[model samples]
Target: MGNCCGTVIEKAGEMGKITLEILGGGEEIGRLSVLVSRNNSGILLDCGINFDENGNPQMPLYVPPKRVKAIALTHAHLDHTGAVPLYFVSSKIPTYMTKATKDVLRPLMEDYLHISGYYLPFEYEEIAKLFKNTKTVKYGEQVEINGYTLEFINAGHIPGSMSVIVNVSDKRVLFTGDLNLAETELVYPANYREEAKDIDFLVIETTYATTEHPRREDVEKRFIEAVKEVVENNGIVLVPAFSVSRSQEILVVLRKYGIDVPVYYDGMVREINRIFLSNKAFLKNHGLLRKAIKDFIEIRGWQDRKAILESGGPAVIVASSGMLRGGPSSYFLRKIYDREENGIFLVSFQAPNTPGRLIVERGIFEEGMVERIRARVEWFDFSSHAGRTELLKAIDDLRSSLEKVILVHGEPDVQRKFAEEISEKYGLNVIIAKNGDKIVI
Candidate 1:
């Protein structure tokens, strides 16, 4: 880590007004970064990255290190924390995140570098520098830096995920970073009632602006029944889940419903579970997580993985890389996909061109590889973001003090429709920002 970076590149604004410069995640869901500045000095929120069509890493628009007084991370996801280390390369900027987030983030970043470091800008040294200058903030705690008060509120998107409140010059701005309004097996829904009061500006995520998720109980029941049916038939049930919250959520759900079949977990999920276990205070229901962990077997090595796949008895396997992008899930898939008795249940959002989406839509694993997949394929909507009705309710709950609404972290077309609807219903100024747009409030 370096000391004493450059001078501020931007000028001071009006005392009461805040300038928000969108660096990324304006028109899309990933690579989310925003600069909140007042009087020349400001903080950077979530310097995330996205992958291009060719699978290249895309970082946020670069801002001079001196221009930012602090960097606030929302969670441990790579999309929100990936590019943060780049800032640490030249400047030892204070990076703020929950202590639990810090624990999970290190392993995730290490895994990311191990897999895709060649395509990234920063290296292991930068990641180490990031932690050297790190400061941990607890939920509901407020800290002041450079004349601005920063408050971290639980976002309920994942363990240690937070929605931020930036207070400066008597103006209050809320940035909802990937929040959930519906409770899951892992964490409670985002509840910021006291925090949402009298907000002057609101920057919210609209990931599911147009879609409403199914009932959580119903989804869990369906998932459980499907697993039981496959297990009863003596067939392997492979569940591809995200290594983070989704994998843990699925496990808790299985344990809640009393799924007695042998369950095995693979890939990075084991490490993530251990992190969650060590930070039990961050979880809404750690007892269930403990029970799930106790019941499930963690795949130890290549030998254990092959034995699980070749075992005679029917069992359920939950693996990482939810999209089947890259993980042991693919190995399990290639081995069992050709069998009709086997089932492939996807529990996470499958981005376009991913193997999970390909199998679900076209019965193929990859684009060019046309192997016929006879296994049963199904996708469940276990989203961790607020859906349409929930999003509307959230706005209604906070509209009493909201002045202007800025929508981000969603598709452009979906954002436009959602913006229009929000504007019409609430009669508030709604803005759908682009990647580089700046809004003053």
Candidate 2:
């Protein structure tokens, strides 16, 4: 659990056995990376890049590059696979992911580096090299590499996202990388079958462990009502969503309800949508996406973006950056801040210190420029992570076989609190991991 930059020292020497290490996703929500090592071979779960001020890569974890044998990217989210190219650029490791993740991530990563204007950590040629090194794995198929057997399960977080199950010798570990038990119109629900009963270690995400989200049906009803209310009032509704899963989910919801309002896709959401379309086979409800693409959705161009502000009577505009950092959402917020007729609906998880949280919680937008924006602000907690109750349920579901539980992807306080809750509630051995912490199985 030490914060040093070297191999974690284990008590009683190296167990000369299989072990799991927390490379990232320890005390934070993003930048999820973990190493599962047995003997001398290692398999990385994810290689995500954290976003810094200005939306550039802030890679803090170091993996010695060469020590990594292969990578299993859980999804295409930047926080899950953004830093993958960095591995290819720096080292020679074969990466594996669902075909959908690769298709979606190829453009997203490049677009991120393009818009940020920061010197890209990896060049385009390097990305091609990374692509060549990547091998696509289908769900449920087990692949053996470097003495470890790996299987990918549907994570339910996003299209093509997966939870990695690793088998090494006699030990088995399941890494639930950003799981969502709730079903969505865009994707199938998670598969937490009885077959997973044999897992020895369950590495779970505690991102929303302190809260419980509304039922999916209730959420959909509220979302439809909110959009309808804004439209009836002749006001513009601005939805700030993540460019990947959240954006696609919102679009599907809008399409499902027969909302004829002009839906403008702006910022990276449009590009990400294109990628989603490209890999339609990975989508859970491909029929719905195809239907929406054919009938309801309208892709916006740069000039068309201004139309959302100027022309409009009752329109639904979904844009990113979801956190309101520096995307079309920020520009739209600044434009509509002073207008009482406008409504801002937050449909994603807003991290601490992000602008989206500030706008919803405080209603304070920037330092006074004379007038205060009094638009009605409402939040719908449609987070992709499992909630507190769901986390406990997941733990209980696996109790019959799981021996040890390792909590990751949350703040220190939250992880500690959840760890205690797990121990008390299930009488399980829990490990609250910090960065670089390792546990032998």
Instruction: Give the number of the best model, judged by lDDT.
Output: 1
* lDDT, residue 181, model 1: 85
Q: How far in Å is the alpha carbon of 276 misplaced in model 1?
A: 0.2
The number of clashing residue pairs in each candidate reads 0, 1
Work out candidate 2's RMSD over C-alphas: 3.4
Show the lowest summed lDDT stretch of 10 residues, model 1: 1-10
Clash total of candidate 1? 0
What are the per-residue Cα lDDT tens digits for candidate 2 across 1-441? Answer: 211112333632254677777778877878888888866458989877676655556664766676678889998887877777777765667888888888878887777767766676777777777788889988788998878889888888888888889988877899999888887778876767643658888989888888888898799899899899888888888889998889888888888898877777678887777777877766877776766656644546657767667786688888888988878888888877667787999998886567887777678655453555588788897787788887887778787788788887887778877777777777788877677777676
lDDT of each: 0.87, 0.78
List ranges where model 1 is wrong by over 4 Å: 1-17
